[model samples]
Target chain A: MAAAWHVRGLVLALLLAAVEGRAEPPEEESPWFVPDHAALQLAGSIGLLSAGPGWGFLRDGVDAELLLGWAPPAVAGEDFLTVTLKGQWHPFRPAWRGWTLRPLTVGLLLSYTFGDAYFVGLPDRYPDGYYWFKTALRPALLLGAGAGRPVPALGLRLQGYAELVATDYRLLHFLQSPATAGTGLFSLALGVRVRF
Target chain B: MDGPLRFAVLGDIQLFLDDGADAVEDLRRRDVDFVVQLGDLTEYGSAQEYAWVAELFDRLPVPSFAVLGNHDVLGTGADIYRRTFGPPFLSFQHAGSRFVLFDSNSREYAFPGNVPDLEALGEALAPEPGVDHRFTFSHVPPWNGDFDAALTGPLEQLQAERGVSASFHAHLHQFESEVRRGVPYFVADSLEHRNYLVVAVDGPVVRVERVFY
Candidate 1:
């Protein structure tokens, strides 16, 4: 428990450092200065918390992101930390009439999880497989589309987006299915992007 | 063609490799159609485990299909799975019915369209003029928020609208069956418990039974 807390603290510190480094950009008109976004997400079917930092950068019609996330190990479970390196390419750079109708983003992600209890089921649930953790590294792809309006006052950008991961493959695998060879669950993220 | 299409539904075999082998042995006595494993076939989705399950699943006299669970997505295990089992989501017609399988583990990756891809499922479930029943298979249940929040109500409504006979899912690791919107959602138990779901589709009637061995 203590070690998990320490790791959490370390991840938080790293996230803070990343945020501070974004304070100044090489160009004033660049999107590199866009502030980081943090969210408290309701993880999957399990009543667990998924909180993390999302960083974005725009350069020459392309948006790149680095998402550092942690799913605090559920009660009596270990912590799960993942670093995702993702980059998105938008076909149309900016909005033509306060509306960015032709914006398409394609993302590539490399994610890694550090922990022993990857999918530990509740004890009262599966008595046969009571307490077992499956942990390892994972690499996934995301193809998404987003349309958003810039909020200059609050330094936030509200965007509605959808992404598809691992669809090109021969099979579709979620992280919680018996057919899933590994932790390949699909996620749908609906949130806002903030810039300060 | 007049006989029932028999298949087995197993869930979250996870790291219980030995237990899964046991399940395979138990299945020897029962000769049926294909076998449908709900999801979580491996603990880490490792190639070794995938090989083990693949080999064991091959022992059956029928074709086998599986959905990907959270545990099976770790590392390159998912990739291994695609290499081994074909695809994560599968659709096939057997015994005058359509079987639509999909992924519903929401928190694993970015927006995955719809975990169960109800739109696709709905199209597949659309009254096939001549088909008798439609069955849907997925890893997570709509009741579990891990599924696409926006699609849950609509999915249940679609199932009811199309009169889907049953929707099978795992991941909860328990034995449960409930009717949501007139469609039965069956959550099978894990393999460690030495159990599997048997679906007998004969002509226009479909029967789902849980058996332990």
Candidate 2:
């Protein structure tokens, strides 16, 4: 239990560091490793809330993020911890009424959970091909839109986004029951990203 | 304020959640007093799946109960099960009939020998003046290979000694029943097969029937 809290502490510290950094760094002072943005999200399959550091490239059109997620027992019926890597592409960004809108954003994320019961490969107790999918790692496809505007005082761009996440497990079950899978085919995640 | 005690027992849900939904609808229309799902609620035992299944169960017009199956022990699945359905070995009485639910997926724990915990089950099945009938439910049957082979005879003997009216199980995914030492053992059919078991007890007699949906 102490180990779990220690890991959680480390992740929290990392996210806090990203959030507390300078609003603006001169081109010469900023290194490639410095994150371009920081994000906080809620209600993704990975966790009830997730926070991360994100890198923006290709004229801020493409993004890569590393997130730490946690779901408390109060909401999720059980405690959950996950680390997610996400990649996204925004093909079009339109400015309307001082708000920049990402008309289309396509993304994918792979998340890994921490626990002894979850295994990436079959355990020795089971024979070959006992189970196909890994419970420890989950990959999801994301589709949605976002809009943001410059915050002059903070020297940052604040963006709000919504994503429809279709996890691998949900997709697998979808084949068996489209009617039941119905709206459950996708879970909604909402978040805010702050870019320096 | 009485009639025959009516309850429905469903088999492994696993990937057949749609079928599970349909079964709940059928049970509602049939007017059962309560319902029980034998186990294997999810294939991978993901929290999303557990949450989805909880929603499906809540749709039932009657109270519901569930047992832990082999698949439900994957990852932190067992803990999730406890959080969702309470401790695995549960005993309760409704309408003078006793119901006992326990974990029989010994193989999931690598045959820990006490997976079924016969001593606890014996206590749960102990007769009381008010309790008119006894029924026990678990995932793997005592005779199945997945069950703790060493504990089979003892389990069967215990159930027989207790005069259990019926012992129900699911995991073979098919419906089968036979008399073991004069007591009935019924294996429920999984939702994939489009059928479920309904048990009705009248006074001293218990009747179980398969209803195809």
Candidate 3:
């Protein structure tokens, strides 16, 4: 299972790199004060999806934004709210006329979850005394990198992002049971971002 | 040579410390792609317990993957799991299916959104253009107080939206099957019962049989 995640991580990294490599110098300079714009997004994979809005400020074609997202849970069966702070350097300034790395952005995120512990599918050996589902506090640190290119012809902004989750798993799971301990939970994600 | 893959899912092999040898021997007689240990393979997540479980898994003929359980995280025990197994939450593909293994054991400590790490699960579950089945493995389920309930509904919905074939979890020790938001959640039996879930898949078709050994 570990090997497969590595392969997928590599694919995502390469794709992000390729997209960033398409950047080009800006065609025209916009007033720094205009503060580019903002967008709403919906993203998901497997049985998880998150949607929310972000506000972006543009200066010399560089954009920085803060995002707030929430997921209702799908496969894992939970819900959470996440806040992300990000900065983007779009060298291509919205469009790439030729070969340029376009817009490359990197940022950090933090999230929190609410509700009781349902502890979905544990085996029979784990007794009721062993675990708890309602974790009041949970936080994660994510280092992310992303790139985008605008395809006016297709009426979309094509972008991709890769994020690494850094956090402790046991604390997050908060297993009150004797059966759980030690393990930390973290993740990496690469996905395309489309603006309609 | 193309056939279904067979493997075992063992949950919380704790306290039984001395009873493990028999389970190891039983596994030797089976043909499997690999074995997946659901977590709590140790009593205290101690190096000593980990070493014992490592030896047991080593006895298997096929490779094995494991998720880090809460019990495996106390003191230096968590460090032991990383050194002995690999990552806590992980994802992989075998026999044409995608297996997303992640850590859901929350509350031994706390993070802003660290426990469930929904983003990570989302990434692991994201559609693989060509893969026929998507399966999720974790030590704790959303219902457990140790898990974040807020993330459960979203996770179930995502699995349904993403077309996940099934979700696997251990920590409860009993065997069960339920549909949450239209997704099948299978909880395997513990080693004490000498039973495990054996999953076989061919494209979109999957067969899960309870095996004792």
DockQ of each: 0.03, 0.45, 0.01
Task: For candidate 2, give the docking quality class from DockQ.
Answer: acceptable
Regions of model 2 farther than 4 Å from truth:
A1-34, B1-4, B130-132, B202-205
Residue by residue across B1-213, what tens digits does model 3's lDDT show?
Answer: 477766676666776533455666777887778888888787545444576578778888888888888777754456678888887878888767788888887655542356667788888878776678888888887666667667767767878888888888888878888888778888877777777777887656778888776
Q: What residue runs in model 1 are displaced by over 4 Å at the alpha carbon?
A: A1-196, B110-113
Clash list (residue pairs), candidate 2: none
Interface root mean square deviation of every model, in Å?
13.3, 1.9, 13.7
lDDT of 1 by residue, B52-72 (tens): 678788887777889988667
> lDDT values of the candidates?
0.65, 0.87, 0.60
Candidate 3 chain A lowest-lDDT run of ten: A44-53
Best of the candidates, DockQ: 2
Poorest stretch of ten by lDDT in candidate 1 chain A: A167-176
